[model samples]
Target: MNEAIKGNILTPSGWLNGTISFGERIEDVAGSSSDPMLNSDDYILPGFIDLHVHGGAGKDVMEGGDAVHAIAAIHARHGTTSMLATTMTAPPEDIDVALAAIGKAVRQRGKGEARVLGAHLEGPYINSGKLGAQPNFARAATIEEVHRLEKLAPMRVITVAPEISGHLELVSDLAKHGVRVQIGHTLGSYEEGVAALDHGATGFTHLFNAMSGLHHREPGMVGAALAHAEFAELIPDLLHVHPGAIKGALRAIPRLYCVTDSTAATGMPDGEYMLGRHVVHKCMGGVRLPDGTLAGSTLTLDQALRNLVGLGLDLADASKRVSTHAADYLGLQDRGRLARGAYADLVVMDRDLKLKAVYIEGERCDLNDA
Candidate 1:
């Protein structure tokens, strides 16, 4: 059955007061801001795509099984239509188990859940010294091990510290195989970061958090990311980075985007939670380790959109930060915009950005979907 939803729809070109008709795919966007078809106190926008989400609803992606569905359902409630199941630094055996489980989820994901596009391996190949909230599982990347992981599941993105031994070559190899390479948890200098970009690293992970900061003289990994990388992900929950720094990054790199970098603490009341192997405390400020290291966040994409708007960005620009840029970074052509012939993945929210409903392939999804 074809369905039409009317409201203030954000199409790729601009806003239109119209009705969007869809089945499995977007059939068309009709009507106009002046002569609208259906009227409501809702705003329609493309569903968000998160490239760096750990978990939510008290479930970690590493837990696998129905955990994937639970997390997806939780985020979908907050406007995420799809996300990459991100993994943390862990022992080789642990990593293998998580990878195999993620692979299984990807293959057998249900229609009611957010699409698990693939895996974003954020660990094991990073620099130990800059491990931030990651445990002491950092190491150099090897082609043999990476190839094995890829066989188990599609590795969409991988974070590596370029200064690690044999890592630049690994970056080149992974990039050649079509996996997005990101620089993070690194102690590399600006020069090394530029070299990584030259070799195929296209982005920075959770910019300005785990990577070195920019310096006027030395210009570290943060500087290289601002000065070079085609795209970068920022945790803009107002806790991971200051609003001023987020504004600066927005002005500097047009392609800079937002990621939840969320954890099991998200959507749950203040409490302690596990982010992979480590224990994190979630309280009034944010999710952090007992020692006060910022482990992750409880921020949802809907809140991310509001935070960006709170920073004075127009709604369209903020939506782009949460949706379009990430999709473009991942090379996904089908989503991230409300254009004709696009996937019917979308979110419905009030003018305040409070999520009211979610649609994945034209199917309304709720917590009950789990």
Candidate 2:
């Protein structure tokens, strides 16, 4: 499986105008001027790692079967090398079915698909008042229930409303078990958000959406995260959060990463699609519910990078927001960087940032079928 490619390779130290050699893992990254293969005008950067992905390509993860594989393959075409199969809030039996399907996808990653790292349980333990696009199945979480679900699949990330009954303690317990807890879909106050962080919740889910607002007097959950959080996820589709607010978050949170938060409408034409238990319509380049509330997005990571760059972020910094910081969030050291001894997961793009090629564990993807 040994292979090599030459371009302006991005590494931890900086960009190197040279060649990178690898098998399943990178073996070497060296700068050279004389190699004929280095003549291509391309940029080599780390592949994207999306932490919040529900579904895509007209298939919903909640469908629970080979649909996860279809979603993974569609995202892989868009340069996502690894992702979490994010689950929406559903009834217990439905959630179990979805988790079991994701567990299988994690165990056996299909060819030409993004690596399904694990599940991101984003619901069922959130506030009923702020159930943005989520069904009305919100309830308090129990440690026993979480433990049983984890047995079906690794819960890499879980979103909880700390203001819910006993959820602060649950956050601490889940953190102790090495799960990355996030605060979202809540009506909690600023003090409650801070308390969740003190209890070991490390990140905020989709900052500025479905959470409390940031007023000068109130300083709600958004304010707490803006003031104190080191890491948070923001959907960069330009529709979810305004570019101005995104800039504010960028100035505030040091490691503000991007997530697709994409639904089954992604990679498909404008039409009706399923997002969990609700049926959403896609039109005017956005997906929405019957009441015109934005459900999920059709954003892909490649477009997310372009959107960030369009917002005046430099390419390198934007790449880190889309790739490096997310890998850092999940403590995955091997997947997000292009360096020796790292996984050979990378994306090749032209000067315009359009995807040229993608590699996952040294296997080149056929973008024609993407």
Candidate 3:
């Protein structure tokens, strides 16, 4: 695999006109090249890192196995070179099994994204009050539960309601193990939000969705997430969040990371879908429940990239959000950059922000390419 993969490289630092070489192993990358490259007018950026993604291309992480491979390959086509296979709230035992199975799949990586960094368990211990669309059976995580699950995966992240019982202690415990605790789907008050943040809770899950609403005087969860600018995840599919709110939140949380909380229905046909035990309908270009509760998004990373730029986000910032910002969330130093030594995962997109090609460790991928 000694090939120079060249493109209009866009790093968090800025864009560069050079070639990046890939070696056989994960750490190998060529630093310099003298060959003249072709003009693409394309945005060649680091391959996207989606920290929170359930399943796509008709597979769910909970159904772990070849489905993991199938869905990941599908998403890589959309430019996600790396991701944390997110699982929905489910029975504790089921969660453990799913985690273990995914751990194996990732260790023996075949197809799909170049790398499966780890697993993101959305919850088993979450506040039932603001569960939003998360399955009801998998309740919030307790301190005892965290101790068990953290040992099951390489990387771990969870979305919790800070107001739930054992929430603070759980955050502290998880943090001690290097597991990132995200605040979301919560009904916590503004003060509670801050309190949770104090416990080394690095970021928010999906801001302004399942959590408490905003009140000028009270300043609920949204207020807390916005007021704390260091970190928060935004599902900028325009459907999950309003365009204006997306722009405003990005402004408020200067270090906002964009994600697609997309489900198995993402690349599938518009029809019936299942999110945990709930039967969801993928219609009108978005997934929804019987009462029209927005289930998941149809927006791809490219769409969100365009959305961010449309909302006045500069290339560098948007590039960071889609790349290194996510890596930062997981504390991964190797990815999210186009430097000489970073993993050679890359994405090439047109000016209109359409994904044309994706490379994982210098291997060209994009299911449609075949």
Tell me which residue pairs clash in candidate 2: none
The digit string of per-residue lDDT tens for model 3 on 142-202 reads 6766666756766567887888877898888788888888988787999999999889788
Ranking by TM-score: 2, 1, 3
Indicate which candidate wins on TM-score: 2
Task: Give the per-residue lDDT digits (tens) of candidate 1, residues 176-230.
Answer: 9899999999999999999999999989999999888887998999999888866
Winner on lDDT between 1 and 3 is 1
Residue range 1-370, candidate 2, lDDT tens digits: 6999988888887778888999989999999444224456688999999999999999999999899999999999999999999999999999999999999999998999999999999999999999999999999999999999999999999999999989999999999999999999999999999999999999999999999999999999999999999999999999999999999999999999999999999999999999999999999879999999999899999999999999999878999999999999999899899988999999999988999999998888889965
Residue ranges of candidate 3 with Cα displaced over 4 Å: 24-40, 138-140
Q: Report lDDT per candidate.
A: 0.87, 0.94, 0.76
Question: How does each model score on TM-score?
Answer: 0.96, 0.97, 0.92
The residue pairs in collision within model 1 are none
Model 2 stretches astray by more than 4 angstroms: 32-40
